[model samples]
Target: MDKYRDRSNTLAKERLTRETDKQASQNMAQWLEEFEATKDRVSEIKRVKSRDEDRYYELLDELEITPEYDRYEIIKGYKRDVDALTKEWLKATTPAQRDSCVQAIIGLKSDMVRELMNTQQ
Candidate 1:
């Protein structure tokens, strides 16, 4: 009976881990999709003429809600920080060490962005 109970507990733990991993992957996929969509919008803004861009910014400012320009600035700053960290990690002594650092930094930045997006929504 004890052996059977132990086996059941092990199976339950494995199932929980698998479920957690599955949810994490799904969340990551959704986050990537949202990030890409935001990037495309920002790129579209850059493609517009300066006058048009200024007009757009003015309209957003007038709305008196969350400013699109400010949000874009935050996103850009986050991207720059991530890029710098990536470069620094790559210069590390060993490939394994560099990869570990890169992964950790990416995870931290990703969590920060996720939190920001959640609050804004």
Candidate 2:
């Protein structure tokens, strides 16, 4: 009798767990749908602005562009570093030193290009 009771209890718990998971999944889907609708509504707004508000939004737009400008600066810095490395590689008196500089330049350029591509996306 106790063995039968234990089996039944386990079955009941499993069923309850499955139902809870299903309900939670449904709730999450509904929440995501509502969130997307809210985002769409926000994007559709077209309001006229006063000069001060326009200036404020312009500053905000500039703030958004800041990362792109920073990335440009980073790329420029990488180019400068790579150029310096190239000159060093050229002027190296020893083959070993030249090889080392070549490796450094290759690694730096690869990293810089990867970063540039990733940021553009």
* Full-model lDDT for every candidate: 0.56, 0.55
Query: RMSD of candidate 1 to the true fold?
Result: 13.2
Error of 2 at 67 (Å): 7.2
lDDT value for candidate 2? 0.55
Off by over 4 Å in 1: 1-26, 51-54, 58-74, 103-107, 110-114
Root-mean-square deviation (CA) per prediction = 13.2, 23.4
Best by lDDT: 1
- Lowest summed lDDT window (length 10), candidate 1: 16-25
Candidate 2 regions with alpha-carbon error over 4 angstroms = 1-71
Candidate 2 contains a number of clashing pairs equal to: 0
